[model samples]
Target: MGAATAAALVLSGCSSPYDGAASTDGRSPGAPGTAAPSRPAVTPTATAHPPNDAVGRQMSWMLGQMNTDPVSSDVSSRFTEQFQAEVPPAQWLVMLGQLRAQAPWVLESVTSDGKAGSASVVAQGRRYSLTMTVDDAGRIDGALLKEGAQGETATTWPQVEQRAQLAAPQVSILAATVGDDGSLEVVHRSGEQGVRPIASMFKLYVLAAVAEQVRDGALSWDQQLRLTAQDKTLPSGTLQERPDGTAVTVREAADLMIRISDNTATDLLMRAVGEDTVRAAAARAGATHPEGITPFLTPRQMFWLGYGDAPQALDARAKWAAADAQTRAQLLEQVPMPGPGPENIDMTSTPWRSGVGWFATPQEVVQAHLYLDTLAGDAALAPLREILTKNGGIAVPDWSEQAFKGGSDSGVIALSFLAPPPQGTQRRQALVMIGTGERPVDEETFVAATADAARLLSEHR
Candidate 1:
């Protein structure tokens, strides 16, 4: 995922909507403002080329716009029509603000294959890469700023693990290779049995359940479902913005749920497939603690349960937990929908406590992935693999196919990857990392550690 999209996800509470209240502007409370600094001239590297000059100029201009009033109409004029449409001015400004908050960057070099180009830059005393595609009109059609090679070398798994062990309440990792015979072999594991809050990763079980129904001819991928006012969820998706009765296909809902961790899409799918069905699927997948998800709470319910004032919130949770699916659904109908306002609830203050959020061990997560693999042939499973591509931040060049699912909320981070080995290699592999603490887990550090660990497994396999 791009940094902007990832930031948006984090801000939206994908790990668990109960974390913190979102501001009216769609940012967390006290999010940094979009004030820009004065524009500065581009600093050319010692060996700057023509392509370098062109991209550097654009980069310099972009930085200037970001530094000064990014939301202004003048800054919006620089982007292509498609870019502007996809990213609104407010969102674009937020993204720019985040980039500026990172260390200032200086253009180093640019490389292109005629049609597309990439620029190297130094930031925070480390090198990073920015990629862009220029249209025939010389307007930027796509752009991405990502950690460069040097950033990867500066951190290692041991370093990250040590830091996590010290700073985090708990850290769990699991790596395994799928044999030709379809059995999984544990290659490495630490706290594999430790259970932690896995935020959106819980959606995988929901996906598996839906897949089984499709396989059994009980559900159709093309089946359309309508949205209601009650179906709207918080950020991380567009469904909440659509009007009532907006029809969407089962495939589309599933896609949105996995790709963006759409809370509304998740609830829609849960409602369509039946809550009991998802719970059954969890049992089949070997989830060690299915009760954690019993009487599954949609994002809205989670918010109310976690953020509603103390005594009332506790009473609601107790009643909801005691009720069956039928009664729980009725209770949900009475729950007030979330809206913009100051939030008194804060999940980050105590990350170790599991409230209404999803919880599972690394082994259960692996089991869920393994079960999904067994149903890969089912037509319903097809879109899932495709949607998962959005979450593959760690690139494994040799892997022919990679599917990923990640989750985070205030103080929790979870990542899962399913990669089929390259041609001539018969093994499939899965890697999972789960972290929890009072302090938020550093995304870049966690991603690098997971990537490095996966790399080691791939090389030795």
Candidate 2:
């Protein structure tokens, strides 16, 4: 409704962002960046003096993406294979194009600490914030451009609750004070007990299930898993388009699943670990409402239920919705899933509103984040941290430990964050918000809640 959040947010896939706490000179109904669009293509802009460090190099690369600079190998070389796959070439093009077209963006200055940097740019005729981060290997983790002032004030808790409430017709938020020992004390709760459809945020539980196998010796991260016809679900990821029989390591699938919300990778991992483990994952993570989340549906099943034109698809969905958990699980195997191509799936409708997909309360998801974070502390399960942090959804300044996952369907959007307070902030924080209605999810509320969450965690509230 204001700036170009609908366009700017799309650049950072809905899954996560390594940086950018989120700023919008405008507001709109759709969840900016979370519900993904098919990768689009475009060119980049040029900057004379991008910084002189890792983050600076990324600035040059990203600036190149916005400007019409001659294409270079910097894309593949500057980013990890995982990063490249996560964002895809088309997304880079379109997202950069959106950032470019949002307004006349001029790089005013850049600040980098060798690992991470912030580039202050003037966009929409106003000075805005754009940040870039890189790993130890100097690979691009993420870049974010948003409307932020240099010394912006922290948002208050009531403001945070109000922002969270604007998400949808039924909005639920769970905010807690996170302890250094991975403990979460309830700080505030607004409809936190209500179960709402979580969309792809369900992948967190799926990740936990896989981690259990890896930890128990039943699975190995590097162990190879082959793609098959059954695994092809849909996007929010790129793996579905890969030819059948393509082999991928379990770790690769997990990375893709969490980082990009790769539906196909999620299905693969879910299959690898089985529904039982995921159910167990919910319980272990302290899910108080088991019936609300059980009978997990793969992305393919989800797609087929909402978009499938097959004769039985509609009826199956109705029966699936009415049946008990055990029967619904049986129906999943007995039913044939035949959904339309990606182009035909209607994105503006709320198919999941009828309770066709994974559902969880904000409180449960918050606990799940703590549970997953606890698992991440284990030496053998160390990879879990990398998987979760692959795409720190909202980019908060100086946050060293950001594990993010956000999901959205037509009318549903859910974002979960669990990270120790950023540098100079001692309070650990965890937040999960779920919004649902009859249209696309709202982005403005998320922006406010995210800003407030950062402030809440930074200070002793």
Candidate 3:
């Protein structure tokens, strides 16, 4: 799950549509209304982290807690009672005990004792060293502390930030805001802002075009389309084997295109809206990466959109042998090609279906998302959002939330999402992460950096 998806769960008043209101283990959302069960009283555990880590940046703030005497549980209970005017004796006892167990620890000592500000502590069964410093206002204003043989150093925070920047040199972020008055602020942009080819993110435009068709009364949302063998683009996405007679509704095709990134469905949808119309829609939405498609669709997009054009007469036989059985069958059945079919066949081989040489900048992809958002409440747009909200083909953490479209090419991975802070604070912002690496960028690194960035911004907001 990404932060955006996680925030969506927080906002939806449930973890997910499939999951009930309670946690998987059945924990309720609201605080226990009755007297809370008591657990063993815990001493303040010395929280340890890397110097450049998140906790390191806030060490100064934690240190400030030592300045004022740690308040007792009785005081906390009294404050709660004062605010509530009636805490009920049972609740008061629970809160009082909680406050007592979790007071801030004083910065007893620093290990290296240098400007970097490292310190060590023995709490519970573990011992940890301090990393960085934060002021009374929770601002990161100090260097990280050094570490010993084991555990975190103060420099952990900066190191993570440095690693994140290096991993994702380019990023495009997209965000949406629905103000108190229902005014929407949707922004789509890239990190540097120039010509960038948006791959699967272009589906947003396809969805928009579908919505326009719906508006014009040319297509019904429930109308069904057939998926023949020709549509199968395999290995990664869902353009696998299918009978020529297989039928899918327009809505179903839309669902597959966005949810599972079905390439064949995209092609069918493109046919409905016309490739030119789709490009025009993107252009209208201010996408700088939009371009005219070649007369022939590339193998990758063919896999992405779910279908491929027929091969020329001379090479049809050779192309047929190379394609999967289902894909070959589709070619034989539906594709309009000139060449004869191939001689030898190998059904087991699966080629990399990276699609045509399409390119998109992070900013343009974000703008594409912005365009899709503009079609809010439209019937055609509704299902696409549902698919994005339900499952983005990418594998993100279950803890983070995201309703997004993801696209990846040889050197680029692009995504645009509007996500709130995981803590669910007052802050509402969007994130666009684009990574182009000499080697394939690590997904974990991208996710962590994006999460950290969202968290940092949320706290500041």
Candidate 4:
């Protein structure tokens, strides 16, 4: 319910949104696709491709094939039969047409790790990020297309804001140069300082609370914690499936919580640090809405609040609305919330916009990252850096010392990053905070837009 998929941090490329956040290889593409029956059938042989511009040529070739009827060779000549089986040539063209993607696709560049690769391409005025799987014979296997980067010889801050709004009707984006003293010098921003739902990104505060505990000697990273049935929340992580008594270290839980958006791990930390502790951490991180996060709703409460017991005698919707912060705390402790089971859950609903999650301003999120950045670099808080750097979300490896925490629910998505600014900028860090909601943010389009934003921040000097 927090993040939709496992978020794998691809060192030099983008991982599939389906990949788990902690896994290094979960983003690997499946075996090459098979040919559609209409095409001239030929076996796709594996060919070794060294890290070179050859990947760009192959991407260009594949893009060139999209304009044809029945996709010359029905794309059988270019892709494996297995790959073609799911998406035939006609459907491919139709999907591209929906995006209004123009033809004569030009390959901007490709990053290959020998086995998998990410290609950036431009056509007309639109940019695309493609995760292409090339078999050993250099045959195409599987591909995931990310849409939304604007087509421009160069991107400007204004256009970045324009593209951000396209991703969500309600959007907030603010980029800043972080000072060593923890102040933010605003560089670019589009939205007001309004508090907005931040979905699982709230886990960052929970993480901060955990780090605070470690620093105060109340908690230790290597300290063992056990997961009970009551502690389990829902997925966007695998921890929910473990046995009730499963034991994990504080560091291990924090890793899963950040890397995979582990709801269970988040709740465990909240338990360890207490909601009051997290509230203090949130205040320190510059949260805009103190009331919204004071109790720090867990995924279980979020899911329950999201799917309120409308028809039942214990209507959480009405009672929760009338309750004060103190009463809300009581409700959390006394109210019967949903468990990990699938029954009675309505994930299809849009509870995020109703503010059932973390609340922060785009600027405040930058503050949050700044605070985290400081902790990450500290000797006592070293685990914080490793946890955050584990998944740098929308990959743009050019950004030095990239650390990220992004969150999403049905109708909300937040992407925040902290890293050193471009050379000669003389800034401690380049911070990006974006939040979009009111409807489900398109993962592909939003991801592309984010990548473009990071790429443009390089010119911040």
Residue-level lDDT tens digits of model 1 in 1-461: 23333222321112222111111112232233211111123333543333544454555566455345344455444567777676666766666666665435555777776547777765544444567665665666677654332123314456546544532447787878887665778877776466677777888888888888888889888989998766776645567778789998988888877766777788788888887899899889778775577666666667666556556555656676456657656655665555521155453343225355778888788788777777775565676666556544367676555776777655666877778875566788888888776654444445556667767666645
Model 4: weakest 10-residue lDDT segment is 1-10
Off by over 4 Å in 4: 1-130, 134-154, 308-314, 318-323, 330-335, 341-348
Query: What C-alpha lDDT values do all the predictions have?
Result: 0.62, 0.67, 0.43, 0.62
The digit string of per-residue lDDT tens for model 4 on 1-461 reads 10101011121233443122111112121111111011122221222222455455556565555434234545566666766666676755555453333454555656776557776654444454567676777767766654323323227777766665555556677777777687777777777567777777787788888888898899999998999887787645668789998988999999988887777888777887887899899888777678677568877667666665544314544466456778766665665554653345443456654445667777777777778877777688987887887775655555765777777665455677887666676775554445455444544445556667777776677
TM-score: model 1 vs. ground truth: 0.74
- Comparison by lDDT, 1 against 2, better one: 2
* Model 3 agreement with the true structure over 1-461: per-residue lDDT tens digits: 22111111121112211111011001111212111111133333444443544444344434433224453334232222222343343543443344224324334444432223566543222222345433344333332221112212213334334545544455544334434333335533335545443445666677777777776787777987776554544332344455676777788777766665555677677876776677677676555543322222433333322223334322333454355545544544444422111222121121112223345555455455555655655664565556556653223332244566655433344555644333444434455555554333333344455455444433332
Query: Which stretches of candidate 2 lie above 4 Å from their native place?
Result: 1-154, 179-183, 330-335, 339-343, 421-427
Error of 4 at 196 (Å): 1.2
Q: Please give each candidate's TM-score.
A: 0.74, 0.68, 0.48, 0.71
lDDT of 2 by residue, 1-461 (tens): 22455334433332233111121111122233334222122222334467678788778767765556655534677776766777787656555555556644567777789888887665544445577778888987765565433222337666665655555666776778777766668776776467788777787888888888888999998999998888887645678788889999999999988777777888888888887888888789877777767677777778777656555666666776677888767756665664313346555666775667888778778778888888877788999998888775665665556788877667666777877765665777787766667765445445556556665654545
Ten contiguous residues with the weakest lDDT in model 3: 16-25
User: Which candidate, 1 or 2, would have the higher TM-score against the true structure?
Assistant: 1
Give me the displacement of residue 272 in model 4, in angstroms. 1.9
Q: How does residue 319 of candidate 3 score in lDDT?
A: 57
